[model samples]
Target: MSTVGAQSRGVLRAACRQVGLPDEGAQPIRIAGNAIWRLPGGIVARIGRPDGREIAERELAVARWLTDSGVRTVRPAIADGPVLVDGRPVTFWDELAPHRPGTAADVARLLKQMHQLTPPASLTLPPLEPLTKPTRRIAEAGLLTTDDRRWLQDHVGQLAADFAGLPAGLPAGLPLCALHGDAWDGNVAVDADGTAYLLDLENTCYGPPEWDLVSTAVKHLTTATVTAAAYEDFCSTYGMDVTSWPGYPVLAGIRELRMVTFALQIADEHPHARAEAQHRVDCLRGRKGPRPWTWTAVP
Candidate 1:
């Protein structure tokens, strides 16, 4: 297997030339450990190994779709319709400015706007949204225990019950917004002036707009109470009635499960990040504290 570093060098070299940026053999500004590069010209290029084609395609489509709704992301155009770069699939990005700190408000407002835009159902069908079984990916990708898998099946099985008591008439059917699917902090960039832009949107899926809230919340839960609070502040600013989104808490359950699945996959390479994923999973499983959703004993 070609190392990510080797494949990234190839992509950046070609992408720099393609995008009219200096190719002086673009130096690797950052490596993704897997599937990415932060290269020269402030470009963020995503690499697709043969095995990672689905990831490449999903990111391409999702980022393209989300870009239309005015979400700041590195818009991807095909590099020769899936040609090989150093024997790996390659996609180039338009450089985006950095994301600055103290811009939680910007983050909140942009996220709110993106969430309010509905995803086209056709996005799920084909040519636009190629469906990959994420559960299967998480499972096969080696990120969950036999116990974790079974637990997820059981917990997600109760999703209907999960949303049972949300107040009715609260933000029901507000358009399903375009999501970053993978909204972790590392994938965000702040420009010199403090503008926030999203990167690596390979997991975009259409669902209740509430899904974006869960994505935005989970990472911050571990690190930033103030950022978390500021996120809540966005709801009112965006003209969203706070009570309207009944699915936030429940959707969090599913999102947490996925986070576990990711953690398991990277336990070896990213032990700390994996541990955090496990902790969040434990919290949601009610293993650490109140499983907030239970509200009462599981009937």
Candidate 2:
């Protein structure tokens, strides 16, 4: 199920009753690591909002495509070409049972497997939502302290790329895959039993496997061994293309910047999150690499 508002949730509850999936009420569940009250028995009946209609269509389509490719996902419902609840758009899904793991190795590998799955050629999706604009917003809004801006700025020159040698177009007939644009840790969920379910496909799009990988690297549990081993296991399972690393690594900085930008927009919603976002910018600034780890929207 997706996120929903108060009245929208009521409208969906009615729809569920009409469809024979009568719900008692929403039992509070932590979906996508966010507190959402999904209908007792229906996932779609729980979400409310029209702003996500276009995105919902894409995410549901990609979810089906990925399911066919052997990835475990929340199945989107089919309800007479999208349902309306008090003017808000709502989608349904079967409640997924997942297990959360304490370490990054397990989570990273799971994400890697999903990354390796190939999507149908006809599946044309959206563009990569880079981190540059978001970060710029944060800067302009006075969301960051002077120190943090300086930190992100220091990374600017270092991450610049040479576009001269870039390929004119993607390979003539290489397989493309369904990509989770905002494949951050918050989108992952683990049930008490230890199974994982990737969530929040609103940012789903069509792109390289790295679109998922670059963000997956920022783990709750940090360890180089876990990072390397998890990726190694994924490579062994999927035989990914590593020559793409140099490129994805640089792109991840953009992700960092994007994250900073998002924080500014939502910082008011949660105090701890705002503090942590600012702290994260500090962390990125301290970590030195061949390229700047701050956001860049060049592509």
- Which consecutive 10 residues in model 2 have the weakest lDDT in total? 290-299
Candidate 1, superposed: residue stretches over 4 Å from native:
1-34, 40-42, 49-71, 77-82, 85-88, 101-103, 115-134, 141-149, 160-170, 183-188, 219-228, 241-244, 268-281, 290-299
**Candidate 2, position 166, lDDT:** 23
lDDT of 2: 0.54
Candidate 2 C-alpha lDDT tens digits along 1-299 = 33323444566576666666656766645321122456654463435344546666666777787777777667776634345555545567776654453244444556666666666776667755454455456566455778766666666535433212223333333345656777654567767876667777767765655556655453312213235566555445434543355554455556655665566544544443565566556656664442323332110
TM-scores, in order shown? 0.66, 0.65
Model 2, which residues run further than 4 Å from truth?
Answer: 1-24, 30-35, 42-50, 78-88, 101-122, 132-142, 145-176, 184-196, 220-235, 240-244, 285-299
